[model samples]
Target: MKVGVISDTHGLLRPEALAALEGCALIVHAGDIGKPEVLEALAALAPLRVVRGNNDLALLWAQGLPDVDRFEVQGWQVLLVHDLADVPAHLDQGVQWVITGHSHKPLIERREGCLYLNPGSAGPRRFSLPVTLALIEVGADALVPEIVPLLAANPLKATSR
Candidate 1:
């Protein structure tokens, strides 16, 4: 199974980001989704699970979003949140992956038996950070993660590919 992971869209859902996530089995959004349309766009692609970011709190429509979410993907337990620092001190022992996004920097690492992944900012470019997202492939025994970088989307020619 393949899972598409994205975060910090802020409001814009780049064409590049959507193109990278095509054909995924599931999608995880770590938050800072500035507008509801972002979720609508992702949901159109696949099953999606998302958490609320700190910035999302000011918006009435996002108020119902959860601060944290947990579920299983291809038998791998996963925790979804926006800020790594806000993760609870106690987590389910079965959780094998912690997915977060807040700093807008991409990260993929493993420590003490759990994998930590951040899909980076796919929205407005910040500073010099490259826009990116991650794809997770679930195999019979282990999970494979890959970071995909998105170049600026060309609206006029975005669909030719």
Candidate 2:
């Protein structure tokens, strides 16, 4: 299963970001969505799993969003949260992957037995940070991750994984 992971859109869903997410079987948004239309746009692409961000707390449209979420995808146990700091001190043993946003820095790492991923900020450029998202290929035996940069020199073209 191919899953597109994105976060911190902050209301700007760049065409490049959307294009990078194409062909994904599922989409996960970590937070700071900025507007209802962002969710609408993402949902239109594929089944979406999302959590509310700190910035979304004051917005009425985001009131119903959960602070965190946990579920199974392609037989993998996954946990989603907007900020890593808020993650429970005792994470569930069954969770093999932890997805988080807020810092807008793309990351993929493994610690203990769990994989931690942050798809970064696909939104407006923040300082000198690269605008990016991520893709995860879940298979029967392993999970593969790829980071896609949205504002590369070519723009809209994703690096081949």
Candidate 3:
């Protein structure tokens, strides 16, 4: 199964992000999805799972949203949330992948056979962080991840001056 992981979309969903997420069986929005339209747009592309972030509290629609989410994909346990720091300790549910976004920095790390992924800020450009997202192929056994930067994914943009 192909899964697209994205976060910190503070109301902006760029075409580059959409294009990169194409063909994904599921899309995980970690948090900071500024508007309902952003969710709608992602839902249009694929089945979407989302969590509420700090910035999302003001919106009425986010009042009932959960702070954390858990899912099983391709026999691997996946946990989704906005901030990694909020992940509970000492309570184990066999989680294999921890997907969270808050710092606006793309990251991929593996420890003790579990993967920690942050797709970064796919929304409006933030500070100096690159606009990026992640694509993961969860097969019968292995989980392969690819971090795709918006600039490289945007086909219309020129790479050279």
Question: Which candidate number maximizes TM-score?
Answer: 2
Q: Could you give candidate 1's per-residue lDDT for residues 29-73 as a string of tens digits?
A: 999999999999999999999998988999999999999999988
Whose TM-score is higher: candidate 2's or candidate 3's?
2
How many pairs of residues collide in each model? 0, 0, 0
TM-score, one value per model: 0.91, 0.93, 0.91
Error of 3 at 42 (Å): 0.7
State candidate 1's TM-score.
0.91
Model 2 weakest lDDT span, ten residues long: 152-161
Model 3 agreement with the true structure over 1-161: per-residue lDDT tens digits? 88999999999999989999999999999999999999999999999899989899899988888899998898988888899898776336688888999999888887676788888889888898788988888887778877789875432211100
lDDT of each: 0.87, 0.89, 0.85
| Residue clash pairs of candidate 3 | none
Better of 1 and 2 by TM-score: 2
In model 2, pairs of residues that clash are none
User: What is candidate 2's TM-score against the reference?
Assistant: 0.93
